[model samples]
Structure formats: C-alpha cells, structure tokens
Target: VRQAMVLTNNPDKLRALAAGGVEIAGRQALYGSLNDHNHRYLSAKAERAGHWLDEVLDTRSSRD
Candidate 1:
C-alpha cells in the first residue's frame, strides 16, 4: 500500500479536471485490450500511485 499522506496530498481538483468526461467511461475500448506490458504498467500505477485501477479491473471482471 502507498503512504496515506501521499494519497491524501493528491491534487484532487487537477484529477477531476483531467478526468472530465471520462471518470466513469468504460475502458472497454482501451484497457480491455491491454497487452502484457500495458497491463503491468496499469497494475504498477494502481499499486504505487493509488489509482482506482484495481476497482476498475474488478468491475470489468464481474461483468465478464
């Protein structure tokens, strides 16, 4: 797990702005097609960057 302080210090407004129009957008057209390298990259981001990628992956799995 990453540090709580780091997680808390994230630029929430910046993320929200950057995610505009895509926060809940399905990843079917992109993430669904990730090759090994891409998948590993996303996994690392989820682990270190505290991205919600694991939850996204889980949602995809549940729908499969």
Candidate 2:
C-alpha cells in the first residue's frame, strides 16, 4: 500500500509553488500576473486537461 502523509492533508494533485514563485498580478514575471484578464488564459489549458478551475480556486481560498 502507498504511504500517506502523517502531518497534513493532501489535495487531489499536490503542487509546490516554491518560494518567491507565485505571480498573482503582473507582480512577478513567472506567470505575468494572475488578475482577471490574465486569469482566463488558464481556461484553455484547464479545459484541455479536464480540470475544474472553480474547484482549484476554492481549494486555494480554503487553504489560505
């Protein structure tokens, strides 16, 4: 059997943003901002990957 984490909960797909790696609004060049305008850019990728943006966003908010 696979081992699970003993300290915290895990999400469907765990990902690490890494230190100073988050770009939420042109604030950083990595993602070039994550505001409304630049946010929709993920729709296509998410659709292709068959992922739910709502669920992802909800999860982020809850975690924060």
Candidate 3:
C-alpha cells in the first residue's frame, strides 16, 4: 500500500497516521516553527519513536 509505504519511509508521516490521519494543519504545525522547541521535540520523536529525522538531528550535532 502506498500509504503504508509512505508512512514507513517517513517518521513524520507515521506519526500523522497514528494521530488520526495527516491534515494540512499537521503539515503546518511540523514546519511552522524552527526554534529549539520544535527541534528538540522532533529529535525526541526520532530517538524515541524511530522517526527519520536525520536532517534535523545532524544540524543539532553540528551546532554543538
């Protein structure tokens, strides 16, 4: 299934799927903020939930 495949490939999508399907608001919420708050939240989700957040995680490490 395309939906399942997409979900498997994308951690954000997986989360969206789990949270009663993805909506426009979900997309906006994810990219709405680029501050530490959103960054940390995304990092935690990646580490704890196996989300594909390499781009954000890599940036965090580089900043250190």
Candidate 4:
C-alpha cells in the first residue's frame, strides 16, 4: 500500500504534523531576493526564511 504525503513550508506546522505522526518527506525550495523591496522599506525576509528552511532541513549547506 502507498502512504499519503503532505507538503508544507511552515516550520511550526511541519513540527506539529511530525508530532502527529505525519511523515516528513522533505522540504520544498523557497526563493526570494533580499534586494526585493518597495520604496517604503527594506526587508530581510528572504534571509530569515532561508534560516528557517535550513533549520527544518537540518542542513548547513546551501540549497540549489
């Protein structure tokens, strides 16, 4: 029999799902630019998200 799978990017949700016995197949790639900003404000969202991605994947190496 084939098992069901789930895909998610949120770390908290991923952890919760895992705790509930959901299998974590792997992490999906997320891409964004630190340079991408509006005239109102500069953002580091991409870098922050990258950190979270690394934490979830438990890898220190870069993705892609």
Candidate 5:
C-alpha cells in the first residue's frame, strides 16, 4: 500500500533519476524530454494524476 502510495505520488523525472522506463518523480508524468510540469504547465499530468488518486484515495472503501 505504501509502495503504491509513493509511486503514484512522485512523477518521473528523467534528469533527476535513472534506470528509466517509467516512474513517478518530478510529480508529473514524464516521457522522453517532454514533460507536463504540473497542471498549469501540464494540465494533462495534473488531471490524470488527480483522477488516479481520486480513485485510489477515497476513504470510503480504500482500507478494505
């Protein structure tokens, strides 16, 4: 659960990280050199991530 939580939180940052295929860092979904810099600059990243967390983070039945 914690692993899922952490991976989902941090977006992949290629420059800042290595052994790269896909990861969560820079707090935004990054591929290639192109990146969505968090909603304002990267609305898609924000929306997708927000949606993902929304589905996962709901307290109603999450613990189950």
Candidate 6:
C-alpha cells in the first residue's frame, strides 16, 4: 500500500484530497518560507506518519 501526505492551508483542498482517498498528514496554514513553528509542526507530522508506516509494515511482515 502507498500513502500520500498533503501540505495545504485550504480546508476545501484538504477535504477534497481526503475524499479522494489521500491520507492527510497535516495542514500548513503558513505561507512563504517555513518558520520554526511550521517546521516543527511538519516534522511532528512526518514523524507520526513514519511511525504509522512502520506499524503497517510490521503488521504486513508478521502476516507474511
């Protein structure tokens, strides 16, 4: 299985992507260059996604 993450400030776009079977990792409200907060937020989101992916892979491996 493949997972996708979308970084957008628009709620509509987020919803549309989610409706389209895209997994929403996080939403970015800030525009332009990334600030410390945005960076931290994105990092946390990525970490969470990584953990989730690890769990999925582990499950699949166990099944196999």
Task: Give candidate 6 misplaced runs (Cα > 4 Å).
Answer: 32-64
* Predicted candidate 6, C-alpha RMSD: 13.0
Leading candidate by TM-score: 3
Error of 3 at 8 (Å): 7.5
Q: How do the residues 1-64 of candidate 3 rate in per-residue lDDT, one tens digit apiece?
A: 2233342425556566657554323222222334676887877777887766676567667877
Give Cα-based local distance difference scores for all models: 0.47, 0.37, 0.56, 0.45, 0.34, 0.51
Estimate candidate 6's alpha-carbon lDDT, on a 0 to 1 scale.
0.51
**Candidate closer to the true structure by lDDT (higher is better), 1 or 5:** 1
lDDT of 3 at 21: 50
Instruction: Score candidate 4 by lDDT.
Output: 0.45
TM-score of 5: 0.19
Per-residue lDDT tens digits of candidate 1, residues 1-64? 1111122222443365345532432222223444545667767766777655664456546666
Question: What shift in Å separates residue 12 of candidate 1 from its native position after superposition?
Answer: 5.0
- Candidates 1 and 2: which is better by TM-score? 1
lDDT of 1 at 61: 61
- The CA lDDT at 54 in model 6 is 34
Clashing pairs in 4: none
Q: Per model, state how many residue pairs clash.
A: 0, 3, 0, 0, 6, 0
Give me the displacement of residue 50 in model 1, in angstroms: 0.3
Per-model TM-score, in order, reads 0.36, 0.27, 0.43, 0.39, 0.19, 0.38
Residue pairs with clashing backbones, model 6: none
lDDT of 6 by residue, 1-64 (tens): 1345655544566667778787777654444444444555545543654322233233434665
Order the candidates by TM-score, highest first — what do you get? 3, 4, 6, 1, 2, 5
RMSD of each: 11.5, 13.4, 7.3, 7.7, 12.3, 13.0
